[model samples]
Target: MRNFLYGAITSAAIATLTVSTLTVAPALSAERLSLSTWGSPAHYQVAEFVPMFKQLLEEKSDGDIRLKTFEGGEMVKQQFVATAVPQGTIDISLTTLDNWSGRVADVGILTTPLWDKSMEWTRDNLKPGNPVFDYFDAKLRDEGAIIIAMFDIGAPVVSTSFEITGPEAFANMPIRAYSKGSAQVLQTLGAAPTIMGVGDVYSGLQRGTVKGAMGGLGGAVGLKHYEVTSNMFVPNGVMGTLIHAYVMNKAKFEGMSPENQKILMEAAAEARDHMQQVAIDQLASLLDTVRENGNTVTIVEPGSPTWEAFAKQLEPLAREATQSYPQEVQDLIAAD
Candidate 1:
């Protein structure tokens, strides 16, 4: 699979950009940027947001700007997207900030458990002018990428055959985690947490390689995770909201005309708003579908044994993870 994926990506790279020189050139006329993503075609990020983004870019640029899209890891792997975009392997890519940890370890701090659980809070605070945005911009600039916009998955839950309502329930249960911070928190809570990309999780669950995963309902539905797991334990923002940013190559962005740059940023913001609403409106209905499909939904209360276990195990870890981040950044996440 790895060989096939690599071969496909190499072929796609060659086909996408037929440049003879080592330095990649950004076209001023009829600009065609390669936009890659790891999202499923059905996922809102792909289905709703990306299409809107493409439409907006084309219309706003009078068809001068075009996107050459490659979805679902066909062009670049999820974890390597940050690197790929900056190195001119791809012009733009969308991925979670947590996945940027390999290049910028400070990004892991942004996933500190139970930090900014409210989707609205995330939306308002992560806008282009906000401190969170500034921090992320500086971080991404340092990593050779620039933030186009931010979108999210609300509080992630654990889907398993058995209930994991409390820390005691975590014993011996292997939980699939996507980020280093979440894995550490789950490990602190006594679960055996293993890292896996979202694309490989369904097979992992099927083979019992992992009993369950920490993921959003939207993501579970998108990936058919509910087909394999029986129960979803919602530990009230236990893992916080999942924040994904649309990031582009810094140099590529710099090469764009100021007017084109404005259009890109505006379009990204518009698409971000639409994606957030789609996610918010679809979540409850999606959860209902999960219930109708014969899975149990367990919503853990704030003061329950499960919640207490999370506070005891996950809270301190959150604090530890964000210790080096700016005080305001810490305060923004810690605020009620």
Candidate 2:
């Protein structure tokens, strides 16, 4: 009876082992992919994306393609993603156009209100027309790089946990601004626009340094800035986050098999689409959550004379900034 019981246990264990081995674990091929994001792992901007993308890519590739990820500024400095990925320091990443705006002024134009209205404009233009991507793709190659996907997932808005009831209420506070346009827009409203990155906004609030920062509702809710500042203003400001690119060092990209190249491009497209959907679908709901948490949402009236005056105050500067670009670039962006 004892021998029979032992044999029964052994048989069960062997059966489990066989089932596990038969499940087809992920296989790492010689080729690997690397990804980098702009901020710390705890920051919701990048964290919310990693799992979704990893699953999408790994599953799509059937585990033969491995993605090695680095978070924050470690993989590549926040400002160097565009230059570095093409130079082979990192394989891919969600690079901010504003970070290296100096190097790629045209790309920066896309991120600012100057180029597009929202993430939807970015996705739509690139999905089929791809005019913007084509324009910048030429520019990127000139800079020793290739941009596989360009989707503006960054939906920058103003959020302060307290009430920024109207334009006048925030006119004089030290608000953190990520882009030059966001800063200038705030300045036009009579606010002290301080330039800083998104990661710093939460800390800036904690230290009593910045009243608010211009970013998306996802960021405001995810970063817990709602805990400090309770007001979120809409149409006050919104910049479509320029995008993430599935960039590969030019030589490395060229080195891959045709099949692998196709997979990489497809993965990039999927990731870009995912980011756009998240930004568009979730932003209002995120704002709602912010309101539920005791914050207020106010939409600056676009047709009001006051709004017209406010826009007039800032329009010339926007026009002047665009003049430095190529003529065609200007013509393409000028409001028709």
Candidate 3:
């Protein structure tokens, strides 16, 4: 009887320990952060950059932090992410500077015609310590978010039903513009600019509501714009590059432990750098896809006569658009 009682007590003690561990383990598990992105799952930033950031952050944090992502505007629309982050609708999100232009006009500097620089030049100049970045970051902070990383989608390209050899091709043409800056560019070229969502451009093209669309090559491939548009004008940097930033809610970011904050920023920077190269390679692949689809691809080399003339035509408009910014910002952006 004594031996049996001792065995029963040991079994009970073992069961209690197991139950305690199961309950306590969950309490010690990694803290989860929520991130929402407007890109579809197939988008490079969704498929590549976000995953890379998640892995790097988790590894760097030693599993102390985990991310939960909502892609394809599941939580907030692309245009609203800038506002949503500040309202704490999402802890983190990706936003284009142009989208923030309504709230912060200085961000429009990046979208101005004066910003016609190569991807390499952009990568070098639009980084953490740069004057442009500092100026924009301060503005964004006042609106309640912090920029962790900034990257380009690619050089801007335009797809049209008609052929485009030079700026004159845009004359009186109806083109879909994704933002006010893009609309301004199209208008300067004498085209009728209609601002629309990225998803709506495909249907708009099919319905003949718009004759051309301004965006990146990756967008052309992803949306299969080549099916409806016969010509793709790759003026490379003449139209300026599209910029997107990964941002975190200011309160959430500030509330984090300094160690975790450092990890998040480091991971974001690493992911941004890696994805910028991916964007370049992806653009090349996407161009091939456009060609394979039997579309004419026009390469307007930067500094060529046509590109130079296009730049000169846009110079006055660029000056007017940037007049609101500080002279230092205007000089810095306009500088070679």
Candidate 4:
């Protein structure tokens, strides 16, 4: 009887331990996600959006979800983030629509100077049910990534070693183009456009390989283009805006619980709104900084003669660029 009782006790203890281990295993296991972006730690997407996303997700998930972030091209370069996210190399990524343009031609519509809308206009129109947003979102989804949020980096500006007093200034000027749309714009303006990466632009300007570089004002300041270039032309709503989209791997996103997916979407929208306002404020301040640094900053007011002249010059190119897109998209641009 004593031996039988001892054996029974040992079996009970084993069962209890197994049950305890099973109960605690799930509690200890958390889903760790990796996010990558090309922006440096100082970039607004890094400084503002990333932390907001991490905090919201961790808190909402009750620590079940965690994020490992790579910034400043640590995991993948900016141009490759679109591919990396879908290929499962990255769980989430932030990249410009221009990077995805080669695969999804419809996205190139936004990169062109066709839309003379202000930042506010763009923001108001980029919501669900909006034809433009739905179109691009569907196109990206077909490519295996889902856009969680969209925000403007800033308005496109040209920083050159020489002053841009008039359209004539761009004649025969060699400038670095960040996208094919920008290249078309530059070429149409009689400027020689050289395709270049953002990282090489400062050096390109410094070495006189490119006399001017087309980019956002924030990028010019963040990358310290002021040190290498002398003038910045803010085309006010003339050159269109630079927009960045935050995306997630579609398979991973679909695999999440609906509640978690909702939480991610909410967090992304909050972060995007916060970043947009901060970007506006930062752009204004950075413009003042550029002026204070003894660099000439020119603003082409939307209705000014210079603006009208530029609008006229680029209208033909804009129409041509939108030819491949759907009629609804072309109408949207024409209406905008």
lDDT of 2 by residue, 1-336 (tens): 999999999999999998876675435243687878765465334665566667766677776677788876667765567678767888776666555566677665654446645566666666524555667777766766677766555546677645664557666888888666457667766889888766678889878788777765565677777778767776533323435554556677777788777777787677667766766777667777877888777766556665565456667656765765676665665532
Can you tell me which runs of candidate 3 are displaced by over 4 Å?
A: 1-29, 334-336
Candidate 4: tens digits of C-alpha lDDT, residues 1-336: 999999999999999999999988765786788988774477786788999999988888887778899877788777787789888899998888887878887777777776555667656667556666777788888999988887777778999899886677899999988877678788888899988877788889999999999987777887888888889899876766787888889999998888888888887888877877788778788899888887899999878999988888878777787676677777866765
User: Ranking by TM-score, best first?
Assistant: 3, 4, 1, 2
Checking candidate 4 for backbone clashes, the offending pairs are none
Report lDDT (CA) for all predictions: 0.79, 0.66, 0.82, 0.81
Q: In candidate 1, where is summed lDDT lowest over 10 consecutive residues?
A: 20-29
**Model 2: lDDT to the true structure:** 0.66
TM-score of each: 0.86, 0.78, 0.91, 0.89
User: Can you write out model 1's per-residue Cα lDDT over 64-152, one digit (the tens) per residue?
Assistant: 78988888888887777877988989888878788888787767766676365577766566788876677778888988899998867
Residue-by-residue lDDT tens digits, candidate 3, 1-336 = 999999999999999999999977854876678898874466676667799999998899988888999987788777787789999999999777788888887777777776666666656667788776777788889999988888788777898899987788899999988777888888998999998777678889999999999986776677789998888889787777788888889999998889999999899888888877788677778888899998999998877998897898788777787666778777877664
Q: Cα deviation of 237 in candidate 3 (Å)?
A: 1.3
Q: Which has the better lDDT: candidate 1, or candidate 4?
A: 4
TM-score winner between 2 and 3, please give it.
Answer: 3
RMSD of each: 11.1, 6.2, 2.5, 3.4
lDDT of 2 at 18: 88
Best by TM-score: 3
Report RMSD for candidate 3. Answer: 2.5
The segments of candidate 4 whose C-alpha lies over 4 angstroms from its true place after superposition are 1-28, 332-336
- Model 2 Cα displacement at 239 (Å)? 6.6
